[model samples]
Target: MSDSDEKPEHQKENGEINGEEEIRLKPFQPWYSVQIKGASKNGEVVMFQITTVKLEQCKEEVEVDRQYEDFEWLQHCLNIVPNVKGVIFPPLPDRPIVSAAEAEAKSRKQLGTASKNIKGDEFHKDCRKLEKYLQGIVRHEAIGKCEALSNFLTKKEPPVRAKLKKGILSNLSRAVDGVRKGGHKDIDEMFQKERDLANDMQKIAKETSLNFDTMVNSLCRISMACNHLSTALCLGMSAEDNGASAIINKLQVEFAKSIDHYGYAVDVCTANDENTLGFHLDLYSRYWLSCKEMLFERTCALVQFDNASKTLEKAKPLKKPMAEAAKEDAEKELNAISEVAKKEITKFHQQRTLDFQKSLILYAEAKVKAARDVYALLAKDVSTIKQMDVEFD
Candidate 1:
């Protein structure tokens, strides 16, 4: 992870691309790995254990304490320009959602009632997602170099979250603006095709995410049911004290052991799907929407330029100068928006391919491991059952 000018997405020294248009890369690409080691609760706030895994600026590891709000502050402070638009801002990982039982468990620890420290599944999962969010943005050429990021990593004090209120007037103005900028006839076929693909990809990602979520939930229920069955199998032990009862008890114990192991395999499958396929699916769904918003900003720029052109045509002789200036300003803004959108869109596609490939590979590996685990558990139980001594009539 070097903060070098050379990035994989950059074009070659020859500057000639294969028939397609060449994209100019930013002069610097900051690369670093960040991790959320664990978390600590301070009153109502949860502080994350932030560790810098690799970076040139900080040759030694830098560890700091931060919270979810601190991350939100960093993300919102990310400025590609004075006004941030047409850039694909990485989405924040969703806030951790815990059930009532998990909440009570955490509360006990916070209140110094619990004897041991233990984290829920959601805690581990959220930390991983947050890690990805930090790593994703910090590797981007423009965003990664932000002073805000450096301060977040190196500084001991957490960032103060900026308060931006959304009032009714602001919401109304935004909706009106969206309507004003909604439709524009794109003259370029490349961009038109890209926009169409984005629309389709967003829908597909959302559907796939929902399906995986349903699948994981079903697996969890099955695991719980099997666990209950495993426990019930042990209840027959105290019924009677006879040879037949003893034999029945042995069989029940073996069966219970097998069922319990199978439940673990089911639990493994749920974790695998959630971390790999399910997590990425939901992530991509958000990013696809983000990219679409970038294009929409470009479209908004187009609309402004078009409106300014029309206004210039209708202006009186004395007002013509002001109108012409407006057109020039609009044109400049449009060109800038187009460049930013192009850069971000190109980055999005490349990153999407890499992410999907990695997710699929990990998902396949998890499946194999889960299957092998269940096989070992069941086979062991079968062997034990065969060796049991039982008297028959």
Candidate 2:
């Protein structure tokens, strides 16, 4: 009956009785199920069919098949939105850098067989990665609400892309020069140091990833060599008593089993390192670089504010028409923008610090576990060798 109890006219369609705007804030809930239908050859290119299903009430449950290139284009378009400027878009899975002929040759050498299709373990891995990336985009607060994302999911055509303009708040060259004259020194130095550190960390991650690949290859080769030797020993022996052959066979089986188990453990460890350490580092590298850019923008804003303040002061004594009034208004607006920029700088620094520390701890723990696993596997192998009554020099 009272004014407070009456609903706004805008809320009537939704059956709301609240006096205020009656905004219906829904919980963040969205679901998409991805299925890799199959692989097909299209002319000279090999493509995989990916089906995406949207599960929501009153929303169309659509199924659309897409190729690998389509997913790449979707990511490229989604990343251009201005509203999601500071957010780090998920990186797509690395496409095979090698030529198809080279890849086929390598596959044949490693597998000891001819390649039949392009859908191998790597294809499955990439599919999982693409699914995760899509899930992340739909769940993000800023990116999820963008109409472009929905279009990418449901439409046959690519989403329209918008490119954000560059420069420090669209300032003129002279204005930017004037602003930089009053730039803060301490903040610049701090951000620069952080940027350098992030670059170094990324380089380290890349080199370490290569090292892990080498280690895995060596392990697999050693395992295969052991298996080959075991088979040879089993075939060469023709004993009348069967005593020597039986002991040799048992030792060979134990050795092969131990090596195989160790190889599996190493493979798992390599994957964990790549997913945890490599993924985190790559993501944070982009995030921190963005933070550093924000800091630069904040610095420019502060400089601009200070420059305008000085101009306003100088114009007070000038016998000019509307000059002083214009400077006064400019100073006020720049002051407001500078305040927001400063707040952003502080927020980004604090948040990234906390996130990086937590992620580093997790990565270290994973590395320690990997080391212990290798050690345990080797120890078990040594014990098995000793139990076989075999003498080693």
Candidate 3:
């Protein structure tokens, strides 16, 4: 072949770099492997250190610090709110809780009393939740492949959150949204039932999470009481070198050690349950809320379609072209959303089953593991006492 007619060596099978017969790259929806390395808060705003890579390209890893607001912006860009696209956006993680101990420390610092840091491991859980949220958004086929997602993952600068609509516009939007959500009669019985079920499940799941948290707190108090008992026993022990008094002191010290171990075990095990079971329950509540919103979006489309059909009928006799065109657009939008929602609902149910099953199994395994941990801690302490040189001098 002539040199001018020949393709470049590098572009041979890789496709033409530049020519009339240029390479037509096949389209691909890239999956991102995302992780939240850490999270930190500045006042009310929390920023996450996120690292992500496009698994398909094996491109250079992109690490960026993103505020929670940035994530909200990403969702907004994907048409999550107003959800006119019939997409169920992944819910953001709940904000960190300021425990009573931490709050008291804050109060002390505010009043200028010397206070030490007493923050719990809430950051760890928050990081996990945020990571999962990112993963969910990226895993979705309907919305994940957007260029906005790429910018969110790779951009060093934060995305600008749009200002909330206020005054008349806000009121008008809310009124319209409310009518759309409530005005339409549900034609699909399955969807109606699913909506009610999802709402009920969300409520129960949230309450269950609170109950678990309360139980964990109560167990924590019990653990503290055990520690106090151990300390009291230790302090009450006699210092005499030999005789019955000495034997009694030894017994008190040994028992006190065992009590201390028990207290530690309770702290460890209950905390595990709190993180495993309680965390997932709270997560479910948020997910259900998003799922419900998706259904509402579909209903909104249905309401629009219903109104358009009425308008088209009125216009037909009058020969109004604009009204007929508007009606056609509405019908197209409604049909698109309906088809999308059918797939979405089925996927939602399937995912829900897998998630709940995994979470429940983990909770059960945690319970079993906690029980064993307590036994081991207490047993090890008691064994030390058993092997103690007990013969009187």
Candidate 4:
């Protein structure tokens, strides 16, 4: 169609015709209005109730009660979303530190020797944690823009399970089918070995996850301790502390950078390990099941074919040719089925081999990157310490 001819006609002033105006739709922009309504506590654990209002014309309001773990889960959920790949979320608070005295008190409380309600001082502390968490997330561009985070804030529903892309297993699917038909004991043995290896990797991933969490919390604790030291130095030295305060301040700044670096790493490397482990475990489970089922089919086909062959062999020469014919037909069909099953078994094994190879490469890369990050952080810390020592001298 010609450009002008295809245009819709519109009447304008002075009897002139003009093309129709194009209509454009704006994308949805969502904002949240949130408040920490209150908190509930058991002996050891506490949950904060949050109230959220979505500030659109609809003005939707949602109330949810969550503990610290729930907040961690929310952040973890956001990390896996492919749509928000480059998004960086704020760090969650470390676990509360309970001194020996506090631990004794908690133990007594748990044993019913003390009251169950949270102490006023402790409640206020927990409240502050909640406040900081809310402030951090709401100001984050990535977390703030996330639909899952929005749902977390505004709704009381079960978390949506993340679906792995079809491509994740496309390479392994056919090979898995082959493994089923051939009923090869060798393939099954290899699969078992690989599955064991995957399990071991999963265990390592979990340990690394815990260690990274500890690293973040440790950095936070160290940062706070340094701040306190700086305050003490300034207070004790009064105005003539030489250069103690300046040195302390410099040290604190360095620690702060280290904390920031580790925090970002937690969101990137730690979160990535969590996601990859889940995907690998799931894929392994499917592989195991497929191999087991295919082996069973192949075994059954072989048994049936054997029985048919034996029946045909025992039949008399000419007395029952009809019976003999039926036996031959049964043998042929079962033998064909057995052959098909064998082919499938081989195909699945090939695909599975490729899949495992790819998985190994991913795991290796992740491990190397994580190691490098730790090395870099430690090196920076050492350099900062040397500088601090010179200032002290």
Candidate 5:
């Protein structure tokens, strides 16, 4: 059809004057728009623009009708809306969260371990100190016995004095030999030897009123001191090693029971989250709990050892007198016996004390190593938890 024939009646008046039809355009509306400055995995930035919708709803519903044909190279400048609320990312595995109960259990284990170690260390130290004190007592007793024998020899009349002196010397020699052998079967035997040496000295001291009285008094004093020291040392040793060990063992047993409780808690938490996560959280909880239990047990052992040592220290001073008395009559036959007993006690203390100290030192070293290992594992677990949180966020 011809252009004139197609013209409507509205333009008929202008048709004779070569009239043309006019087109109408709508008014632009102000709208909220976001200019994205950065690109996210799931969302993109809009360089510039205004739209007639809320940014919140526009992200999901806004549409672009105009094509940028003239500015083809600027296509990247056009703002695009994302369908999702946040940046799109790959799904991550759900990480197990450490629960309050699990944390508490672990802490308890760690605390127990630390306490045990401290106790053990203290016990060992005390034991060593006791041993040292006992050794001193033994040496003092030996010296006293020698002096007592010399005094007895001086008091005796020529032939008798010589015979008594030889007897005293022979006894002293035997006592010394016994000590050097370090093979006494019983503590009583050792004490009996000391008593014998004291009696010999007392006998000689009784021969002359003035000198004998003085010697008797000295022998009594030394004997009393040695007896007191021995008693104290024995008490201390028993308390430190035996008593402390018993207490630690009990505590450790309790700690082990706690582990079972922790395990149960973990199992519950794991079951609760198992369906959602695809893996068992109880496994991690149980593993960590096991570590804590081990640490607790070791600590208990350490404490027991420490307590034992402390007990020994407490006993050391108590037995000082007995040790001293044994030394005073070292020269007397009876004094020689006391010296032998004192020496044996001292030797026992030294060996045991040394052993305790060594054990504590080794335990501390192992504890530190284990702690470090645990820390590394905990760090890894925590990192995994963080990553999971980020994914959800």
Candidate 6:
């Protein structure tokens, strides 16, 4: 009830102090207000309504009005909370970008596997197609040449010319159809038919010297066609083997032996007489030489295809397993850029080495043929000189 007990003006009721006790007023504590800025879908800046709440209670409690809106609400109490005082939002982890070389290598490996499988299936089909086309070309060319030669040799007899054309066309048609249908069960069967036809034509020529030119021309055409067919078969076999077929190596050996046999036969036929020799040599220089070149080119193409196929096949086994392993390892340790580069370079070198080996084989074959031709020509010239001397004696 004394002066010391009087209430301050701010705390007094009705401008008068209650006689019981003096009431003290507490000091005001500062509160911070936060405004969150965000973007809207139409590229306009949107201001969010200011929110007031304790910083400690702001977790998962702040609701954004729009799903796509960017916003954050931090109340005063939540900001001042001991644990939230130094809170920092971290940026997202960056995604790993694959290098172009790595991507290309992977694509090549996959494409190679696919190409290998596809090419295997296509090899025989393509061989058959090529055989048919070549047979047609050979028959047409032979018939035209034989007709001209028949006119020169047989005194232009219509009957003989007709017979020759009919026989050649019939044989060629049969061979082509057989090839198209994949009807030849074995190389032996195909060659047997070819040999029989050749022998029959040879006999016809022997019976009539007037028809000799036509016969020789026909023989040359037939031999060239056979050689082409043989090459195609060999290529198909090689492709099959590369495609993981068990028949590849076996076919390759068989075809090589067959080629050798044909080579010998051609040589024997060429050695028999001057006319036949000239015919054979001319055919060899034109068709066989070109064919050899083509074979080399085809070999290179097939090798490329095979290399791609093998790489792809090799990569297939590694894809899932390697990627999984890589992923697991990646989780433990991020993949270094250098590791990827090394893998790509290694694969490129392997492909290059394979291509080089294939090219070497093709080059060697060409060189061997060139050497054989040189020796054969020299021997032919020597034989001709000896024959002339003997004639004079």
lDDT of each: 0.78, 0.57, 0.75, 0.55, 0.33, 0.35
Instruction: Give model 3's TM-score versus the native structure.
Output: 0.78
* Steric collisions counted per model: 0, 0, 0, 11, 44, 6
TM-score of every model versus the real structure: 0.83, 0.55, 0.78, 0.34, 0.18, 0.17
Model 1, span 20-67: residue lDDT tens: 343443255555678889976666667789898556765578899988
After TM-score superposition, the amount by which residue 28's alpha carbon in candidate 6 deviates from its true location, in angstroms, is: 99
Per-residue lDDT tens digits for candidate 3, residues 1-393, read: 777666576567455445434434433355788999998777766678999997877567889998766776787777843334766678877555545666666444432354343435467777888888888888887667777888899888877777644599888986788665754677788777877777788788778877877677667667767877999998897777688778778888889988987888788777777667777777778888888777787778777777887887777556678888888888888778777777777888798788878878888897798789878877887887888777775
lDDT of 6 by residue, 151-246 (tens): 221231222212113378898975665354333222234333433433354444334433444444444444555566767766666444333354
- Give candidate 1 misplaced runs (Cα > 4 Å): 1-27, 98-121, 167-176
Worst 10 residues of 5 by lDDT: 83-92
Instruction: Please give the range of 10 consecutive residues that has the lowest summed lDDT in model 3.
Output: 110-119
Which 10 consecutive residues of model 1 have the lowest summed lDDT? Answer: 110-119
Output the lDDT of residue 206, model 3. 78
* Candidate maximizing lDDT: 1
Q: What is the overall TM-score of model 1 with all chains considered together?
A: 0.83
Candidate 6: where are CA atoms >4 Å away?
1-208, 238-244, 275-393
Model 2, position 328, has a per-residue lDDT of: 65
- For model 1, the local distance difference test gives 0.78
For model 4, the stretches where C-alpha displacement exceeds 4 angstroms are 1-267, 270-282, 310-326, 389-393
What's the residue-level lDDT of 201 in candidate 5? Answer: 38
The alpha-carbon deviation from the true structure for residue 139 of candidate 5, after best TM-score superposition, in angstroms, is 22
